[model samples]
Target: MVTSSILVLFLLGLTAAAVLAAASKVLHVKEDPRIAKVEGCFPGANCGGCGYPGCSAAAAAIVKGDAAPEICVAGGAEIAENIAAIMGTEVSFKEPKVAQNICTGGSRANLLFDYEGVEDCRAEALLYGGEKSCGIGCIGMGTCVKVCSFDAIRLNADGLPIVDMNACRSCGKCAEVCPTGAIRVSGMTMDLLHLNKVDDCLAPCMQKCPAQIDVRTYIQQMKQGDMRGALLTMKERNPLPLAVGRLCPAPCETICRRNIADEGVAIHTLHRFVADWEMNSGSRVRLDCNPPSGHRVAVIGGGPAGLSCAYFLRRIGHEPVIFEKRESLGGMMKGIIPEYRLPEKVVEWEIQTILDLGVDVRNGVEFGRDVTLESLEKEGFEAVFMATGAWKVPGLGIENDDAEGVVDAVTFLDEVGESIDALSGKRIVVVGDTNTAMDVARSAARLGADVSALISCIQRKMSANKNEVKRAAELGSDLKFLTEPVRVIAEDGVVKGVEYRELQYDDPKKATGTPKPVEGTETVLDADMVVIATNRLVDVDALKDQNGEPLFEMDKKTGGIKADKTTLQTSIPHVFAGGEAHTGRNIIIQAVADGRRAARAIHHYVTEGEIPEPKNPQLRVIPESILKNMQVVYNIPRIRVPEISVEERRSTFKEEVKGFVEYDEARKEGSRCLRCGLTCYDAEAGAEYAADPDVSRFDESGKE
Candidate 1:
């Protein structure tokens, strides 16, 4: 019975095998052998420049009528003709093209600032716009080198990228990865003729940036709807984006490339959007550092430079403790700058991030008095960074300068900035054409004071930023330019008015060619109070040694510590100075730059115990050749930044620059960026590698 069961099971298995073999032959859809023959003719580059997935897929698609013979760019016409013969179809080829660097501007372009971030194009592009002064130039980083599947592109001696036309397959990877649009493929027709198109060079606006943030990349990130990415990029250099975004003078806009076309791009307005978005989203930058290096750095002054020093020092595994002789951390940023120009909340938010990076701030501690440099060294501090900002404003040296009701610009702004109501119902006259004078005049006017801004120079020659001049005028301040005050008139030891004379210059256009007082042009301008804004005085007395000698040599002209231009290091190897202590009262961005340099110098000294020589931040200068290669842009109107009407702004201390830009507005403004560094090239069907008719001898039907 077992033998009979086994025989039946074996016969059933045999029948099942017979049916499977028959079904395989009947149901199979055979792949055309010609498809394999056609795919073999391709160069196997698999570059998507042909608009297909790969060579194999492209081969199948061609035989099935889904793809054309001209799709393989790397293989060119020869491969197309060979594939056509295999498929028994006629073929026509589109001229093949190669990639090229469009921008000729390399080291020739002016650099906005020195870049020392990640050595990648994308990473460095996120830095204050980019290190290159030209917004659209090769960053000189080897991202294209690393990204290319074929080793075709290399950086030239001047740090600009060059693509080898012979090896480039037009994969478009380098162009896709370029942050500054410094690489691209050539046009097919142009490639056939060996004509490569080059981009125009340099965005002068980017060159004007002190912080050197890549304005182009940040805007590109924003346009792609990546708010967090934009914020992260801004934070790389500007730790206090929110504060500076509202208050900066924005020299960048003055030299904007868009100016040649129409109005300048509203850079600050777009920055405000990025800053506000980050603050609203509660986005916090995560700090990553190496293990503590067991070094302690003492940073004097909690102003921009000092704060910047502490912030950067902490990031590099050092412990930084800031000593501020104030109730709060920010020196002038918190005390003197008014809430409207830079709101109290924004100040708090921006500085708070620096403090959160493990920085220790000891308020009410004066640098030399509370903690002397000698004492700090004895207490095991590795280095000292002095950044005490200019807290005192110089007197006008006019008669009765110290009379009652006459206040220094710093002291007056400090008081009024805290309470705008303090200037109500008073007549205020500010002496000098400076940021302080403008702020004081504007603030006093906003608080219902009859205000006048006095300047010794002509209106066009005033050193103050043009925006400040315009805003003060719009706020109803009497802008009396070219009027020099000879003395402050006093009554009962209080300022009653200022005695001034109209001065005539030899050249009306020149501000500093010796002025002669016009005969009998003396006049008294009445005032209830006078605020002097002549010059900034660094508080060096606080940082002086016990014997009345300063800790560092003085600059004499700037009235600050004499330090190296790039290193920010004082004469002492272990000591560094920055901000007002080194440069007097310059721009806030300058102060930040000083602080960053001092931090690096201090770190080098602390770790290596040797002072580093000052080196200028290197940037590639755009050549005159490309500078003359101008691209004419169509008139695309710039986005207008909406502001509070004059009526509403005068009544309240609310923000006068009212509205921030939306995504659409920001994108529209960003779209106008002329990609200057784009290096695009194309390949041609060269005289060599002609189609071989000998391939027609191969059997196409497979019947042979």
Candidate 2:
């Protein structure tokens, strides 16, 4: 019976084997031979840096043409070459990347509660946004260090991860494991392009400054005795550092961290000192630019905006030609600004430095009279930048404003430097209470004009620049408040006096009151000339085409070229406007910043045919409440900036603010900086996370 059973089982096994071999022959599929070759070329690390599951998946994708040979980041150039050889294709190279830690606040960061949870960062982050006060800061748990297969990252004494660039394969594993996104893998493009995001760390001074100069870095360079390095750093954002250093009102000083204790650092003076150092040493710092792109751009108006636009355009390999209506560059800066404030030699030097970068200049070339938009297009210019200044004088709301001896402040300042003798022993009455009016009154007094009075429709406190008003008064100009001009009394189309009336406000208690003209207060002030200090408008006629059609759309409110505030692009697709052309009478720093942004926009539009979206779309806003909470222990006093005496300032056109007397003095002032960042200050300023008895610790339930 056993022999019969064994015979049946053997026969069944033979039948089963026969069926399996037949099925295998019918259902078999073939695999690509190149997949194995590609897989063999991989580093076999399976780091997932290629966005695939493993080497086998990456190899299959490469074979199918879904992925490029250079997708294997760990394998690098050698492996990519080998894979390309096997796949019978050329390798497309990509920018190499390295890991960087975005958060610098480690031990200096504030805390919410003591963390006694699990050792892992991922676990600790589950309770109440981690222990650090900054939600986006590093968790200080070394999860990134553990996942780094190449041993490129290690935890420092401050519990922050430090990346070793040499061993880093750009695998992005550390960035992947990081819970708070503090660790990131960035490439060359990411480093060069600065776009603010919600998670970005920014200092208060950086956010306030229109140019966004790296205040902390430049001051640190100054402290380290790197005067040249500091100037170069300033030149990266602001092309006219020397002019800005002397003339900027310094809005950055208002929000400085040192203001919490004593006073803000002398940022403007430091900037001037570094810039003067470069000038005195007779060395100019011009960065290496890209090869010429063979594209020509016409920049109209040789002002701050035009110079800045040309500088950046040249830096990015595009040829820029500047067209100026006046004989010299620096629209208002060279024409209007008194030599006492910003010297002519400094302005000349600043403009010359920009010209040395291969930028072409055509003086006495008016935009409307000489060259139109169509003429520029016909001249093979790829793009046009309208960086015109606020030259058009607005109406004075008074009759006979067009008469002789009645000149606008812009025209007066422009002609004052060349023809100071024309105003000798003349009676001058300056209207309006703006800083420009004060400048006119002061300049007229200095040039031997018997200034009748400086009149304003607004209250005394409401006038522009109190110090300027006081200076004009000290220079022998009479001050007349709450007065409005009615008409320019002229004989034979020449001014003899200015008719005016005193204004009465409804709310007399408040200084910022609504003014009404008194019924019987008309009066006339005797004068030889009336200098109206009304605001300026853009020359729209200069922006017209040959057919009398507007080349660019006009902004109704601004009475200038309309442009997107962010992109600076006008209605015309190829033409762009910035600085006083769009925004009238802005600071020099703002004009420089606008020029840079407009240049970038133009470059992107010309080259890529589209505007480049910001890499980081949002800027993190640090609350003033939190900023004031910083425990500032240092009581260091602010260093005094050296300046010429008032007597000397009135006599000659020498620069009013003499720069730092010595390098050591400038260095000592630089060291007083708080070195602030986003939620971070100098570590010496007592850490905000110090233990407190009143504060709650980690509860048993692990709740906040």
Global lDDT scores for all candidate models: 0.73, 0.79
lDDT of 1 at 692: 31
- Model 1 has an lDDT value of 0.73
Assess the local accuracy of residue 429 in candidate 2 as a C-alpha lDDT between 0 and 100: 86
RMSD of each: 20.6, 6.7
| TM-score for each of the candidates | 0.69, 0.79
- Kindly list the per-residue Cα lDDT of model 2 for residues 396-487, writing each as its tens digit: 87788888888888878877768654566788988777778877887887776788554555535544566577777777788788888899
**Tens digits of per-residue lDDT for model 1, 1-704:** 99999999999999999999999999999998878887899888787666778888988898898887767767666878888788778885344567877565677556778888778889888766778666777778889888887788999897878888888878788888888777877642221112111233334544456665557557667767888878866765566778778777788776665554445667877777888887777767564443467899998889888887787777666899998899898888886876678777777888888887788888998776688888889988988898888888878887998899888888887887454466667888888888878888888888889998778878777777787889889988988877888898998899899888887788776556866788898988898899888778887678678898867788988988898876777888788888877877788877776766676677778878775553333233333322322333243456677887888878777777743647776776665554333221101111121243211111233211
lDDT of 2 at 618: 41
Give the Cα-based TM-score of candidate 1 against the true structure: 0.69
Q: In lDDT terms, which candidate is top?
A: 2
